[model samples]
Target chain A: MASSEEFNLDEYILHHLTDSQEWHLPFLPTIHLPEWLSLHGVMLLLSSFFLTLLFGILYKKEQRVPKGLTNLLESFIIFVRDDISIKYLGKEDGRKMAPLFCNFFFFILMLNIMGLIPLFSTATSNINITAGLAIITLTFMIFGAIYKNGIKGFFKAFIPSGVPAPVLILLIPIEIAGLFIKAFALTIRLFANMLAGHIVIISLLGLIIIIGKVALPAIFLAVGIYILEVLVAFLQAYIFTLLSAMFIGQMLHPDH
Target chain B: MTAATFATIGAGLVTVGAGIGIGLIAGRAMDGISRQPEATNKIQTAMIIAAALIEGVAFFCAVICFMALGK
Candidate 1:
């Protein structure tokens, strides 16, 4: 970004998007964290620590009446339990799995919201992190199905009845691939969304740098995208949890 | 033409495809909600799920285009 000989716009935008040891912000000096732990790593750990401390302290009060933060957290938990988990999985399994679904929702929601804050970076924007999260969902989807339905039932779920034996040869592979494709879609949907959002925001600002004037409309557009990013942060988290519950639900009750 | 150019074009087409698919879904959903306003909540939920599923495919292809651009 520093105009040495010639400034490269692509490099500027990509640099802001990619994770690094140093945190960069407009009109502020770069702050360098430890080389071993990248900026995104710090953001990831920060969100986890914040969530744990917030919940651990608030719930430890053990109040007969829920207070401010406790009230908020409880509401979110109920939303996850009822709207997401129970709605998809049956009542019994939904209750059993509410905790895991809550963890996914809050962790993702926090990670995303943290990114929107100028002080922190977006950890979920990274492909590896999103892929890791999707893999956890995949593990539960595969194992939960097998556990509830047994091995025979797991495979049986793939083979729909009355789909002639001749069609079975072509259908089996596609059905098997569909399982993995769902997880792959989950990974890309998250990574690309965050990636695209950051890129657009940076590019909007980059226009001013490249063109050598403070583009006022560009600033407004960036702010608009920033707000959309916030909405997306929440939406993506909800969608991920919703889909994960849906996948597991589908597995548990294949007939449904 | 360069590979990136082709990838860019392909991504544009993917977006168009996803746009039409979602448009169709939202159109039908609107009709359903208008006919049975009481079921609006259920209809909206189904609409969002379907739209998100198609958006996922679009993003997946866009990511592949990005890989090509990176190369």
Candidate 2:
């Protein structure tokens, strides 16, 4: 982008879309590492570390009638546990999965909020990151299904009970496919929402460059969008966590 | 018109449809809440879920439109 003399929208958008920087192992000469490190991945690791360290320090300061930042953070934790995890995942399983739900909610919330900040890239905006999160969710769902039902019972999920012999053949494949579809939906939902929000913001700003004379109105519109993007950041994080819990709940106690 | 123009038009068409679908969901949800203010939370929750589902479909269309741009 910097190399080109004339500004191109395609290059501008593509530049913003791509990971700008990455890090790789320098010491391991013999070991092969894939294109593993990226801006989003680094941000993810930073947020994870921040969450852990913050929570670790906060854990020691716990008191009755929680106060200050601790109170606010605790409320968030309780909300995720009760509203998201327990509400969807059920009392028994939800209680067991509360820690995980809190982690998912906080981790995503951190990443989404960070993305809004100037100069920081959105980790969740990356499909790979969101897909990784969705896969973790799917793994939880699968394990929950197996734990609730035996191995045979788990496979039996693909075929609904009391179905016609011929219908079973068609139903089984569809049901199995549905399992992956759910995860894919989860991945796309988060990734697309995050990505679209940024794209919209960048495009709005680009309007100023495209129409140089009407910069004032375009700037105003872009500012409005920036605020909405802040709200969307939180909303998307919450939605992702809530849907993951619901998917896990459905698997834990299959209604069909 | 070039493929890019068509892709832009297609995306606009998709947005038109999605806007109506989401608007319908939101309008009904608002009506329901107005009729029964006590059930506002429930209505809002249902509205969000429906809107998200509709938005998901719109996003799928958007992905197709994006692919069309490349071709």
Candidate 3:
């Protein structure tokens, strides 16, 4: 176990929050290996395992009517399917894409919620995790667009129909850049939201230590921020999944 | 200024931008919701998602600031 003195609050928070990755330095002499496994990776696995267990328990009973945890889970699943997936991707496409979107939504939701738990870290707080998700969505968008519109149609969609030949030259690049920027934005957005919430909470708490025990107002501020952070936990998760669906929807029917 | 102070500033700017973006989104969503109460669920849901996306960007900015401060 690490000593308390060796790991202060800032260090403790940073240590828990950092990712574990192996880096190579072919041209350089030093490459630091992170001391801890990526919290996001662990949470990803844990959420998957929990989802499996929940499904297994539900299946084992073979209950015709939903009850208890199963019912709650069913409602969430239905909400994603009906509201997010179906509403965005449409019935036929949504049905096909349901599992992917469902997984994405629940996985992100669980990860966001994890930060709220004491002594646990949030996976979604990590940039790599959010970037990975954004990349996956980007890939789906690209492939889905190609599949729907064909390669010729896909490229053609980049140029707005009303633009003249001369303007098309500039518009096409701008449009392409816009597509990439949107995906890049998604990555930064998720990473920033999750990280900021924790930081605010930490900074608020840090005030007690910085200003000493007599700072009663700081304590109240910290408590208030904590409550806001709780709302943020849910809000961030909802936003991440919603933007993802919107991106997918745009790619699916670009003409709109 | 110390790295930590710089980070604090950077994080502050990010949140400010996010606050503005969210305010706009919420304003529009509220307008829609008020006009059509029947579509409140849909509007609210869309608003929440848009808010998250904006928040995500702010979150990214915060993380970068943290890293800068730590170093």
Candidate 4:
């Protein structure tokens, strides 16, 4: 880390945004971790740890009527079951997939909220993590469709039934591309949203370092964005979970 | 112009496209809410989903433009 007098805005912002094996604190020694242990990996592990602890603590409370944390968590699960999965997916199947949807929502929500903490980096901001999650959704989409309608039906899905023969060639390619693009878009959506939020916060904070005391008012703007980031964290998690369920539901009930 | 210049312009253009889409969604959602008043929850959910999908494409292009700047 450089002294404030020799501050570099680009390097500072990029440093805070990108993942690395080393953790650097301003005016402190840089702590280097093992090659396999990266910063984003650490954040991911921390979030997962917290998630498990939360669920573990809640698992034992056997009140017939849910209250406190149990009540709140139950409400969120019900929302996912009723509003997301059940709304897009059928009743039986949506209930079956509720646990998976719950996992996706809370895991992502944990990562997003944890990232806002001062010492933590955002794992979702990494393209690889988001891509991995998107790939799971894509796999479920393709496989769910296959399971529902068999292998022939999956292929038949690309070609609308009773369509003219010549149009098949053009339509098939477009349909296939559409499937992949949707998955790709899912990947970018989470990654870009988290990354962009962090970038804006860091950039605004950096103004104080790059410039002088004249930039003090920028802190309030940064705080304003920070509050918005809190909302976005929840929103992005909900959107990701909702869209994933929607994609799988579309495959299960393909009209065209 | 250099690649960075084009990259910046491309990112700006992506914002323009997505901005209009989200604006339209917001406007219609507002209109629908005002007209029906009872369907606000459904309308708001639909609006967010549609806006998020459109923003996904915008961010995809923006990510490419950003990578170009690194080149």
Candidate 5:
């Protein structure tokens, strides 16, 4: 039997906050597995696989006038392509990136919504996962810059043309840092939004224990927060995808 | 006051500041849209982007508060 002394609110909260399981490398046990390979790894893998399977099914069973999940998925894909990718990245590049952007948006949406399910953790809530996603966007940005302007021209565009030598020197580092900061901000934005919602919901529910018998109100409040979190899940996914497209667009046309 | 107390206050201020920032952003966006009704879509898109950026900074401070509490 468990002892009463083992019951600690802080520990309980901390346990709730942390990932349920983790694993390290076989040879180097001290080094934790990368985010994509940890327990959140399963969630990530499932989300990606589910997205692929959904798309494949939708494609194979193309309707004369789409219905059900096919119709819903088509709208989301078209929205991402039109409002997010094309609006930010323009028609030429946007068309090229439409599939990738849709993948990111749906994958993240799946992960965020999964948090609402009992016993499932949010993969995007982890900084490591968000950072890994941001790194993918960063790679796209760099590739876009190189593709648009050529390697030599890409570096040259950073100086902003016709600046004093001293100002140019100062501007160079800032521009480079700005590129990374955009990705860093993206990582933090998605991670914080997801993590904060879970924390708030948990904390609100925890208040029932803290308040000691005034539990009725607390449960209602927690329910309210849970509903709000469902909305946040969709909103954050959309925001992250939109911002990624915007950042990549900036890199593609730095002169603008 | 303890460091955690100070962190709590700091975190509260961060939330307050972000709330104001987002409010101002939405208020201005509404004003812009009202003035130029045709630009409602543009204003709303810009507003959402701005609010997300501000919320990101607030979350950074909230994380700091968590670190303090954990300590």
Candidate 6:
């Protein structure tokens, strides 16, 4: 119900960016648990719950053959498995990893899209959320590599073939650094894209107020940015999922 | 500069960095696809995924800006 004129740009944007939390613990000081029944938490739970229910319904009706929504969902699943997982990970290994990759994609895509809504704080926009996702991917990459190549082979994989002994001294450190860097980069990408789109949209909207009542041009610019942001919402989500699949694929087939 | 101004600058830089990274990824992907048209789907998919990984880093930078600026 707040008007643009009355609202402070920084405060307004901050309010939207802030996660709804439960009461702050007086004793714990640092622990600011989201209010147990916050809108954000509730939305997250509900979205997850509904997704699970949909999956259940599809599973139970498996014998009936896919149709309508079920058909669409099945097609998407098959596309990710065949196109992304198998293409990168190879057919045999890709099947095992498909579900995990698919889940990560959809979960992130949904969360990113949710932020575009009028009154939602994107959980994926949070560092904790993005970091957790990066960690999950990292865990999969490390463990999957070790599992496929064995511990010795895993370490050996870092040293590309044909490198001289002296070069290895430098290569080993660079390779190790690259491994961690890739994971750290993954964490930043998703978080930044989501956050950037929102900030831009909010800042553009703030322009109308900043320039005062006479700035009609600013209003038009803000509208344009808002539309652009809508497109970015989907693009960012797609980018996040696509990278996750690629990382997993790389780990699955280091030779490639 | 006020925290707000700093946050704006920080966010702008992150996006610029992401743009450059994605441009590189897409360029390589296109080159790969051209070499093997039959593998275009696979190459395109891989490119998109790589772009996302880069985006994740940019996202983290933005988050830091938000934390610094937000009350």
Top-lDDT candidate index? 4
Candidate 4 residue B17 C-alpha distance from true site, Å: 1.4
Work out candidate 6's RMSD over C-alphas: 5.8
Per-residue C-alpha lDDT of model 6 across residues B1-71, encoded as one tens digit per residue: 79889898988998799899999999888888888899997687667666666665666676688688764
What's the distance in Å from true for residue B32, model 1?
Answer: 1.3
Show model 2 residue runs off by greater than 4 Å: A1-5, A22-36, A58-61, A161-166
Q: Supply DockQ values for each candidate.
A: 0.87, 0.57, 0.61, 0.91, 0.81, 0.56
Clashing pairs in 2: none
lDDT of 6 by residue, A91-203 (tens): 78888888887787667767766666664467776767778878888887788889988888778878888878998999989987887777778777766666667777778
Q: Which one wins by DockQ: 3 or 6? A: 3
Per-residue lDDT, model 4, residue A14, is 79
For model 2 the local lDDT of residue A3 reads 31
True contacts kept of 6: 0.95
Cα RMSD, each candidate = 1.9, 4.8, 6.4, 1.8, 5.0, 5.8
Which docking class does model 4 fall in?
Answer: high
Question: What lDDT score belongs to each candidate, Candidate 1 first?
Answer: 0.90, 0.81, 0.75, 0.90, 0.83, 0.72
Candidate 2 docks at the CAPRI level of medium
Give the per-prediction TM-score of chain B. Answer: 0.97, 0.95, 0.92, 0.98, 0.91, 0.86
iRMS, all models: 0.7, 1.1, 2.6, 0.5, 0.8, 3.1
Best by TM-score: 4
Q: Which docking category, incorrect, acceptable, medium or high, applies to candidate 1?
A: high
Ranking by DockQ: 4, 1, 5, 3, 2, 6
**Model 4 chain A — which ten-residue stretch has the worst lDDT?**
A22-31
Give one digit per residue, the lDDT tens place, for model 4 in A1-256: 4888777787777777889988765568878879999999888888989988988886546889988888898889899999999999889889999998999999999999988987677899999999999999999889988998899888877878888999998889999898998898999999999999999998998888778699999999999999999999999999999999998888887872
Q: Which regions in candidate 4 have their CA more than 4 angstroms from the true location?
A: A4-6, A24-30, A59-61
Judged by DockQ cut-offs, the docking class of candidate 5 is high
Please provide, for model 5 over B6-70, each residue's C-alpha lDDT reduced to its tens digit, 9 standing for 90 to 100.
Answer: 88898889989999999999999988998999998888989999999999888888888878866
On the 0 to 100 scale, the lDDT of residue A12 in model 2 is 82
Question: Candidate 5: what lDDT?
Answer: 0.83
Cα lDDT for residue B27, candidate 4: 98
**What DockQ does model 2 achieve?**
0.57
